[model samples]
Target: MKFKDYYQALGLERGASEADIKKAYRKLAHQYHPDVSKDPQGEEKFKALAEAYATLKDPEKRAAYDNLGQRSSGEQFTPPPDWQQRYKTDAAGFDDVDLADIFAAFSQAGGRQRQDMPRPGQDYEIAAWVTLEQIFRGGEIEVGAELPEYDQNGLPHRVAHVFKITIPNGAADGQRLRLAGQGGHGVNGGRAGDLYVVLAVQPHPLYRVSGRDLYLDLPLAPWEAVLGGNIEIPTLAGPVALNIKPGTLAGQKLRLAKRGLGNRDGSTGALYAVVRIDVPNQVSPREQVLYEQLAANSTFQPRAHFATGAGA
Candidate 1:
């Protein structure tokens, strides 16, 4: 067989780090994936990338491959005399088995394994993000997944499919949804593997999420903070009124009990409205007169500490 430069296939150097290898593989996989790639040779390129990733991702396999030294393309190649004894027993992980067919084809071409037996397909995992609104309402989410398919002639190709997944209320980050028989196709009538969607909640500009709790900045006018009143506030459910107490200071947090994210067990978390007092940057003539009158009449002394320190 012709020599294959695994590192060159991944566009990496001989001493590339594990993380670098994975990054390169993922980029190439997305670009050459049969389902989404517009390139006519996408399938072949994907296969090559998969083989390179599979061989290099494992420490033992990588070391063994590296021991063979540099090789030129199109040159006749053979493994070392003790290759089978040294590396044959090393196995690839489930995640890297997407290209098992290519490896099997090589083995079969060399007359190693029985051709009649069937091999099960490989499982796949992909990272996905869900909107905070979707989690709050809890409904169906459409996820587009690209996967490899095969023609009647047994040639491999890629296809994209939309899967409707039901997201539960209060679905937190790092959650996973498993779909059975949705991953890679099996060989010779073997059953297909599973697909896993690892989920993360997208960041929201209005609120910060922590577990089931939600925190938001509640901006209040200086007079509103001092006088206290019912203020309209926004929540995941909708706008609601919150009663603020008199003399409420900045940075004070007000809790809306059981108003945060809902759980599957019928429980809900509390929402915290953190107080932030705002002052007018430019005061009108009337406002300035009112502020001057209040400053003369009001007994509130905000600089009392500084006065006491100066006195001491």
Candidate 2:
């Protein structure tokens, strides 16, 4: 069988401490984890690293591996007669057995007590897209994911799971809602892991949100902008009357208190109506004549500062 050098795979020496082994595994695992890595061989490298760490992290497995003596990585070698007799395994016709499998058998034989010990499962995080309306009011959303489940032999397998998560009122964008004991299943008598649902607010057709504030574009005619009157504006709740001040300019914001998103602390955000003056596409002859009369009679100089070249 070809021998694998677990210490070499982890870039550690035979005499390295347990803390060093854990630290090295964590660093390499983060870099090569299949979900986040961009390397072409990341999956293969990650599996190798995991296998190496799995054996080295355990005292009994490490002792069994160390008994095999030092050999160059991938070099063909035979296990010592004493090592085979200790494990009570006949090495005859076992050439195809991988080095990892050999350690698995060794662990099964020597680490039965360790295997029965409780071990907590891994936690998982999933992103969920929520609508603005849902954020305004508490609601439920469904999400599906694959979680790990350990079999009778202590082998992990992926199992599909569906969960309905409750989104609380005033749940902010990017907030994580944790569901206790909903992640990977635990082994032995350990507790299951938690599932974190991360919220991502979907883009709205009529409103833009910042914190809890809502901004909506309010279009008004020239006369309405100049005359100042009550106008109906649409909110998430329904249409509400908004008072427009006379001579309101474009790009001005009119605030409506407590009309935005609700907060968990029983507070509410403000809604701003952004003013936009709109003109008719076509005007009648009488309207054109009236416009002409107003233009000739009005003394308004909107571009008066341009004449002084001060803002040119």
Candidates' C-alpha lDDT: 0.77, 0.82
| CA error at residue 220 for candidate 1, angstroms | 0.3
TM match of model 1 to true structure: 0.66
What candidate 1 gets wrong by more than 4 Å, as runs, is 1-52, 55-119, 188-191, 306-312
The worst-scoring run of ten residues by lDDT in candidate 2 lies at 148-157
Q: Which residue segments of model 2 deviate by more than 4 Å?
A: 1-119, 187-191, 280-287, 308-312
The digit string of per-residue lDDT tens for model 1 on 156-274 reads 33567888888886688788899999987777678998899878788999989888999999999999999999989999899999999999999998999897888878899889999
* Candidate 2 residue pairs in backbone clash: none
Which candidate tops TM-score? 1
Clashing residue pairs in all predictions, respectively, total: 3, 0
Per-residue lDDT tens digits for candidate 2, residues 235-259, read 8888899999899998999999999
